[model samples]
Target: MGTTRSGEAVGTAFGEYAVRPVRVGEWAAVKALRLAALRDPVADIAFLDTYEKAVAQPDTHWRERTARAAEGADGMRQFIAGTADGTLVGTVTVLVEEPGTTDLAGFPVERRQGHLVGVFVRPGHRGKGLTEVLFEAALEWAWEVGVERVRLIVHPDNARALGFYRKAGFVESGITLPLAGNPDGHELEMVIER
Candidate 1:
């Protein structure tokens, strides 16, 4: 329902999808949508975080997360794209990780950076270029927050994810981290420097 970056009247990109922040107190919706993503076929390779753990989190957890991503301090943002019908089609979160501080990847983050995570587009919405729009919004927000670069990691075998990220101007950094939840799960780190 909001205007685009140019302040033009917004219309459906492919007859759906409007990128916006998840509403406050929409924690229930957030929880359910994420559970659905966790059950997706590639979740094993897509996320180091799990649905089982997510669903088990208390209402307060969802509350805190939504609040932080939606309206919290300036370090993070969660953008969800949805249909005109209000069905969430895709989601991603941007975390501004500062230099001299360790990041989620357990690496010594040397410069200010933004990290993208929890990216998912529902089965019905894949291939509509929705993810690219979502990434653009995130990358813009990261730069606004003064990060020098933005980074993401995907499973080594996930060509689809790699393709999307590459098209979005991310390049492999030749760095990898073992998945925290699985012994064999390894992630390919990619980044776009501002």
Candidate 2:
């Protein structure tokens, strides 16, 4: 359920739930839980990639994705919140995007940074502070990876997500990116600097 090798108190709540990186061989469960997240009601604004694309992915795709998050030296992390029953309730993936010619959002790279994405909390688990625990673990991972800044893009219209990011100490970086599928959509870039 977790990276047993790194059971270093990633985060805990009520001593019942733990947020941490998934184990190396848990790719199947990771794939299933992430697919469940993509089906959430607000998925359209919450994700740049779609469920159709994710669901159609082969087992190899999920394997690679999970493996990278679990143990990739390239500085990627995927954290999950699990209950005593072993049910995954929330997830957040942080990828260290190195400075380069261009980015997924078509922004010119300035310096090595961490990009937060694939954030999700099951509807039934909302308001439980699980998201906070997830974010804490993610930020810790970013710092461990030597990222100078961590950023996330949220739709300007999604007030809920904006609040969460703000509460986590992320501020508007005064930057934006054209929404991938809908050019008219406004993506507010928010960041927390190390």
Candidate 3:
């Protein structure tokens, strides 16, 4: 029965972890979690950034990124599942998409919505329902901000993520985006609406 910065009830704890939004000035934790996620085996499809590139980023980059998603930032929100020992084992970020702006691919946003990204959980933290709790926190934030729909893109080959997204109430939107570097590769778009 813990709450986020916005005071939203983030729901029950799972084992040793509790889900909540990352706080301001916690860039180091954010950076560490992201670096860990990039090192995962499915990093190629699960994220657009590479471990090499992420590690090379200066501290300022991480600081600013963290500030943008920190509590009270209107444009982005990042949720993490922190263990009782203070280790963050999982995270998810949501970006607000305005109707007048373009998506990462330059596609026009048709309406104001929330776009989920940077989803991850440490290898040892997989299963046991941590991911679901993280999603619940992230989605709860989206709905609180008045977004009627939320979307995410997953590489078609990422079966694990696809299954998880579906189980979280996101269904295929039938939209596929071509990978930036690999022309033949594509990611499927999924959405969850109230």
Candidate 4:
């Protein structure tokens, strides 16, 4: 566990890595980390967007996206685990969903909640507890924002992700969302109430 420090920073120690929110000027690093995540073997099931699409996005898009998630943003925040030298090794983004808004699946959001998305840890950083630290920062921010709960959608075939979510205290909400191109396949919704 970590203590809340100045700003939205969490003083969690993971060897030489520190977990903190992304900065506006670090857009390039953000884009780089995301692209690397999309190149992973399970990327097809772990991420909603493909590397081809993300790679095609212009620099401006990455800049604006990072700006939206930078510190002080109320709608969304992205937390990253970085080395002492500033190499980002993992990341997770939380998007605050208000009551009455439709989620990415077009389903109504019945309560104020945090939607966890784009969770990734570099392959080399895996098994070092980086992802757990990232999640702690993200969940802390979400609870601070007064969300009722935090939720994440996972592909049914993504066993590793499901196991992690369960270990992190998220339980299935009994909701299954249809996959875009595969009508027979669906994603499961898991949540951790605040």
Candidate that scores best on lDDT: 4
Candidate lDDT scores, in order, read 0.81, 0.81, 0.87, 0.89
lDDT of 2 by residue, 1-194 (tens): 22343433334553577787865677888888888878878888888777899999999998888888877446778888888887877889888888775666777878988889889888888898889888888888788778899998899988889999999999998987787757786788899998
Q: Which runs in model 2 stand beyond 4 Å of their true positions?
A: 1-14
lDDT of 2 at 6: 46
Candidate 1 at residue 117, lDDT?
92
Runs of candidate 3 exceeding 4 Å displacement: 1-12, 72-74
Model 3 C-alpha lDDT per residue in residues 1-194, reported as the tens digit of each score: 25443545354577788787776677998899999999999999899899999999999999988877875476798888888887888999999898989998889999989999999999998988999988888888888888879999999889999999999999999899999989988899999997
TM-score of each: 0.88, 0.90, 0.93, 0.93
Clashes of each: 0, 0, 0, 0
Better of 2 and 4 by lDDT: 4
Residue pairs of candidate 2 with colliding backbone atoms: none
In terms of TM-score, the best-performing candidate is: 4
By summed lDDT, which 10 consecutive residues of candidate 4 come out lowest?
1-10
Model 1 scores worst on lDDT over the 10 consecutive residues at 6-15
Predictions: Cα RMSD each: 3.5, 2.6, 2.2, 2.1
Please give the distance, in angstroms, between residue 116's alpha carbon in candidate 1 and its true position after superposition: 0.5
Tens-digit per-residue lDDT, 1-194, candidate 4: 24545544454667989888887888999999999999999999888899999999999999999988976476999988888888888999999999989998889989999999999999888987788888988999899989999999999889889999999999999999999898999999999997
